[model samples]
Target: VVKYGKWLVAAGAVGMNVLAARDHNRAEDVFGALEARCSDDPRLCDLGDGGAYLDPGTEALYQQSVGYDRRARRWLIGGETALLGAAAMFVWELTRKTHRPDNIPFEPEVRSLRNATGVGLRLSF
Candidate 1:
């Protein structure tokens, strides 16, 4: 059970990390698209004291990119947490003591009755 739990946590960590990477990539793509759009239109690149002036559509796209970035950060945090859990489980398993019994030695006996001789092996569990 402990072994399985460790593996499960490790798998979850990997999954979360993968999701984070995918979201990060998506965020990059969206930001790149936004940049391309801004470069094509000078009006979209106008910067004021507050921030760059963005149209409604461009603003929505920027917000989408921000959302992706936020999601990526969340997944990364989750992945790190799962990875730590897995590491802790591994350490716990390593430090745990097993309840296995000690090895038992086998004894062989030879008996002779009448004109017959037989050998018998004995084992204790």
Candidate 2:
């Protein structure tokens, strides 16, 4: 059960990371577009009081870029959390003790015959 939980957590981490990567890519694309627009229109680059006043179209693009950037950050945080969960599960598994039936013991034997010689393991329950 712990093994399965570890696998599930690992898979979730991978999935979250994939989503984060996708969102990050989208954010980069939007940022590029925003830069291009600012370059084409010097007025869009003007910043007063720490914020530039933008036209409706430019404002829409800026909002879109902000949204993507925010989403990417959220996905990245989720991915990191999932990764930590997976690591914890791995540590738990490593620290766990193996349980075997007390009545069963491993017995190793050496066998010899006219034409063959081999080693065998015997277990009795």
Candidate 3:
């Protein structure tokens, strides 16, 4: 089985990185504020370093808002677990060659019970 492949990874990355939804933006504004404060005289920017910056470079507040979302998405697919599963698949062999290598092989015990004829749907949060 091809588990936790491209579809899961891309969906997770795109949704979390862009964060184009309205509700998430509103929540960010409620919890976080823009660095728009120019404390010294309204003409100078308060760089949060106790020093007044004459012309602080412009940076979008939305950039900061997406930082944690990116982390959350990268971890959504359980990458480490998938890595371990792949390692285990390549590490073990279920069918040993007792007869000629070209002889018909029986299905592995685990797969015989775990799989079915109909389509199977998988979903996770």
Candidate 4:
């Protein structure tokens, strides 16, 4: 059970790491696209007024991309948390001690009990 648990935890950690990497990559892609668009068009820059001007329909696309990037960031955080938890669990399971009766050095001894003499076992680690 311990071995299986460790394996599962390790797998979960790896999976979460992969997910986080993918999300990070996606966010980078979106940022790259935004940069590319801005570079390709000079008008995409901020105007002199407080309100910046964007191409027709381009503003909605940019907004949607930003929203997607934000969502990806959230997923990345979740994946990181999961990965950390799984890694800790894996370490805990791997480092846990198991008790084996055969491994213990138990010796038979004569002992005096209350109102009786009896044979007893003494254990030594």
Residues 1-125 of candidate 3: C-alpha lDDT, one tens digit per residue:
33444345445445544443443555366335544343334554434564434444312433444664455445544454444555554444333234545443443332334556444444333
**TM-score of candidate 1 relative to the true fold:** 0.75
Best by lDDT: 1
Number of colliding residue pairs in each model: 0, 0, 0, 0
- Candidate 2: list runs displaced more than 4 Å: 48-50, 101-125
lDDT of 1 by residue, 5-117 (tens): 99999999999999999999999999998899888996876655767455766777788999999999999999999999999999999999978656757778899989899
Question: How would you encode candidate 4's per-residue C-alpha lDDT over 1-125 as one tens digit per residue?
Answer: 65576567557656756765676676667667767777888677444454544564446446666766676666667666766766777688768886765865787889889999999888775
**lDDT (CA) for every model shown?**
0.88, 0.81, 0.45, 0.66
In terms of lDDT, the poorest run of 10 residues in model 4 is: 45-54
Q: Roughly what TM-score does model 2 have, to 2 decimal places?
A: 0.73
After TM-score superposition, the amount by which residue 91's alpha carbon in candidate 1 deviates from its true location, in angstroms, is 0.7
Model 3, C-alpha of 47: deviation from truth (Å)? 14
Candidate 1 wrong stretches, greater than 4 Å? 47-52, 101-125
Q: Per-residue lDDT for 4-53 in model 2, tens only?
A: 98888788888888888888788788878878988898787665575744
Model 1 error, position 35 (Å): 0.6
All candidates: TM-score: 0.75, 0.73, 0.26, 0.54
